[model samples]
Target: MSEGEYRVAVRALCDFTAREGDLDHRFTPAPSAREGIAGHALVAGRRGEGYEAELPLSGRFAGLVVGGRADGYDPAANRLEEVKTHRGDLSRMAANQRALHWAQVRVYGALLCAERGLEGVTLALVYLEITTGRETLLTERASAAELTAFFEAQCRRFLAWAGQEAEHRLRRDAALRELAFPHAAFRPGQRELAEGVYKAAATGRCLLSQAPTGIGKTLGTLFPMLAAMPRRGLDRLAFLTMKTPGRRLALDTLAV
Candidate 1:
């Protein structure tokens, strides 16, 4: 689907890819970046208190596991902080920001509570401007019970979404499998092409194919894809034939 038509989750994937690119350009260990972050904060707010950054626990898959990186967790302060970089003014701290930032921090807070002995943890969203270096800090508190309930809800939502995706895929697979090229036996390399197409479709990929005559190309490809529907969520595909006779042929071929 087009980018504009994509779901928010899909867009998030795109956003993540962009961030990965940024990390690639200047990849620095969280530990190494501590001084840098503190320095940036200092530059952003000369009047602010001393800025200190640390990488308590780092994992490449931490966000996927717990939701997002708990950039800084202060067991002493009973709070967590996430650093974000934005282009525009950093003075604006809004409500949506509060909820979203809290959700993320709760993830960290929950982790800290689980790993450490903290009962509850507060979260901070430290937004900093790229051009001006100005910064703003927004903090929200979340209890252990609150985080647990919220995370469970998140899991339910994710599962529901996954179920829908699976259903969509199954329907497409069924469509491909049930479609027939309107021929009896495989011709030349048609069997291989059909097999390849089926494999690609099953894995949810787009393919460009050229089939030779008498190979039952439509039937070969479609049948496999259709058959995979139950397992891979493959369902439907468009079958367009230029000739009126070809459409009839396609229908007849599937009968075999």
Candidate 2:
């Protein structure tokens, strides 16, 4: 599983259900493991299937397999999801080592592709505990050739544990278990500002926002600004206020 081979069961469920020929979008855990992760993919929207999952290694190797599991997998969409229990906050991961976190899902994707003899696979890392009441999902793609190359490299480097994959998985797991939300719930109007900032950043548009006297304007402005700032090239982000009080307050908020 070269990099992130953690989602084998998802592919299996999709495979099994498809073989059943029911177009059974339902995901079911393989009668595979004794215990571990347990969730199913949403599958094909209304045609979705659900399932429980095991984390055991197939065709057996020497030691216990370190990481890999999918609570559920949706074949139609080629998506594999791993469920995590955490004090949810997606941005906390933005500063995380990207290669490592992405490796697991990419590897898992490779595994899924191998299982179904597929040419492509999609991986989703979902966190259910987010403050926004939304799951944090990260997606990636794996082509068969890519998966094969990755899996072969993983097998070669994995046992010796010389690659970034294992490290990436560990960091991701830790962040999920221990990382706190970088910012709390959006201020009363922060969500709107954040959305606007996100759109502006996404499309390279300019933005102008005003905060009257006392709302938490700094966060209201900066939170989304930070989130979208990276999406754009980030030449520089300036908060200019003519009023001493407003500028003082904005500068003070930046300390957070």
Candidate 3:
């Protein structure tokens, strides 16, 4: 947390900017979340004593925060890895997924290089199979400058979107601070609902409210959600409803 800093996770940055091509899960085979976690542990356990697992790392690119926990790092060997769990043919992975995986590791490599002040480092993708417990290793040696350049390119591609998001947040928060209640006064449970929404957004958590009808639910939720824009660093507030009528209610709430 610092001035002029745009906080972003390393995974988010790579997922956002490095994505291309249509979604094709036709060939890729992967394990469940729980299984993946176990697989990661298995690989980390097999590493040398000098290796560090779940290495929390971060670096900056023009105020954008790029951060992630690399699966493992061996300081002695100067290697960083991103562990992936899979089953079936690894060659079947889509090109887009491969590109994204490389992008993530490159950003991580740049972070590692910067943190260690090394001229270059080895980046690896360690894929472990859930069924056979076999591991596939893919690696590349990259200079710090090259990794930095790669990281910069990804950040640059996303910079404009980030800028617009930041600007929108400022405007939205300013409006919220000065926003007046749609009605002359609050309803019975509306104030509490609004407060809950604001606090949830501020804390970056979910809020579940259960109140009966006729409690100004629309305004209650929308108002505080808007008010929390700046503090929460929210790029957008999405209001999802099951039906068209509910969607209209949300839209009308905003218009008010």
Candidate 4:
């Protein structure tokens, strides 16, 4: 592992690597966000006292940190489940969708097994139909080795991107930490505006500075923002402008 590493959630991993073809909303048939939360609660309530809901699980794969919450788990039964709430016929779901769901649970199974020091585990996908109030389950038993392999395969798919992201973040942080004011001296009002921006960024707040045009506003804003980026742990900086001329001026100042 390098000094800097990429962290990813299990859901993100499945969403990033397991997805295929165009995004199709028709086969999903998932419930609304609010309804989905309620559905999960209802299902958790129905389970036995041994049932664990919203179980947090995490594991490290290569240089990436993968973590997420499992919907339900039963230690005594050695079962880990991913609950999905839907509104329509699940049979209409795309093969890739089902594969993606299974991939997520399998990774969760691996995480649980590693965390609990188990040799094997059961992976289950519990689908609830909102309209019919029916539950359908698909279960698979996987040995620890199989689960680990599945987790590694998924991580391997994202390893290149994760590495690049980590490298970019490192370079950005290094540059930000060493950045200095561009010009020899700040304009009359530029110092105040730049100071406000730096303080706002450092404290994680918003800043609205009102200044007349052509007072070195662009360089003043950019200098302090770049200088504060490392301190604030910012991943990206966006300078939004209203006009094409403003964009050109901002870029031109940056070139200085």
Candidate 5:
């Protein structure tokens, strides 16, 4: 959230930078979120007493804070795992998905080596079938240096894009700070609405406001919200409305 620093979960970092090939969903339907959680728990329960579940791992690379909880780790075996739950045939799973899975575990492996100061670790992909409660594990032994190099390579790829994003944000915030209300003066009761919106945004609080129609409510809300965005370091602002007319009003206000 800070300037020059981008915080990303290890899985997310892999999902963004390591994913390759076309997204194919031709295989059987994947397990549900709840099923995946339960599958992970079941797998952990089957592990030995020395096994550590949800082990926290993190590392820094090129101003990026990358962190995530590994599914399970065995100190005795020097093994780290990433558990994935699925349904149907494993062979039918898309190559791209499998590659992404490997990418995730490798990043986790890199972080684990850094965290524990290990020379190397066994990176594993344990795929569990929810319906049958069966597990198929695939593993590879990787040295600390190799994993670290892989992690940094991915970070370098992400850093180039992140630098562009940060520059865009800097320019956007500067523009927002310099923006002024379109009209010369606020309509009656509109100033109160604008002030309330600004306060809510600045303080990170919820505000419930009600105003009658035809009081310049659209502009009143949008202008102050835009003005407050830079102060709060907001990355995005979403204006939701119930109907098309409401959306049009908000867009029309922006045009003015």
Candidate 6:
């Protein structure tokens, strides 16, 4: 959230750099988001009293802030787990998906070792079947140095992209701060609408405004929003419309 600092979740970092091969969803229907959450809870409930569930882990690599909650950890065993929910045969899961799962858990392993000051730790992947309540666990032992090396490798691959993105945001924010209205003057009621939008954005409030046709509502609204973006530290702006013509109108307004 600061200058030169790029934040990313642990799973996101692995997905961007560790994934390989085609993305195939044909093996089985994926579990719903709600089901996945419940499955994780069920797995956590089955653990021993010494088990810690939803363990928050974080580490920094260069300018990137990486953080996520590991699914479970057992201090007694010095083990960290990453739980995944699935509905079908585990053998049928795609190889790339499995590889990505290992990549994520290994990163968690590196973080856990660093946090606990361990020379090595056991990394686990716990797969739970939603309907059957079946659990399959795969685990491996990794030295802190090895896991750290892997973690740093992934981060090194991602830092270049993060740097480019940071630079783009800097340039964009600078440009947006100097944005101006496209036309020489606002139509009747347009200036009021623009003022309302600018105030709402600057103060982090929601706004609703109505203006008659030909009041130049699109430009009036968009220009103020862009002008307010840098002041409010907004990362992105989106314009949503209900129909094709509305989309085209907004696009044309942006073009201006």
Which candidate has the top score in TM-score? 6
lDDT of each: 0.55, 0.51, 0.86, 0.86, 0.91, 0.90
lDDT of 6 by residue, 139-175 (tens): 9999999999999999999997887887888899998
- Residue 56 of model 1 has an lDDT of 45
Cα misplacement distance, residue 156 of candidate 1 (Å): 3.7
Per-candidate TM equals 0.49, 0.38, 0.81, 0.84, 0.96, 0.96
C-alpha lDDT of candidate 5 relative to the true structure: 0.91
Task: Evaluate model 5: give its TM-score.
Answer: 0.96
lDDT of 2 by residue, 9-117 (tens): 3234223222322333222321222221222222223235543243222321233133356455765576666554334344553323333345555556666666667
Residue-level lDDT of model 5, residues 38-117, one tens digit each, is: 99999999999899999998899878999989999989899999999989989988898898888999999999888888
Over 108-221, each residue of candidate 4 has an lDDT whose tens digit, in order, gives: 999998998999998899998877778998999999999999899999999977777778878888977888777788889989898998899999999888899778888888
The order of the candidates by TM-score, greatest first, is 6, 5, 4, 3, 1, 2
Q: What is the lDDT of residue 226 in candidate 5?
A: 96
Residue 48 shift from truth in candidate 4, angstroms: 1.7
Candidate 2 TM-score, true structure as reference: 0.38
Please give the lDDT score at residue 117 for candidate 5: 89
Separate clash counts for every candidate: 20, 14, 0, 0, 0, 0
Q: 13-117, model 3: which lDDT tens digit per residue? A: 888898889766344455888999999999989988988999999988788887879989998888889998998988878878888889999999998888889
Consecutive 10-residue window with the lowest summed lDDT within model 2:
30-39
Compute the lDDT of residue 117 as modeled in candidate 2.
78
User: Clashing pairs in model 5?
Assistant: none
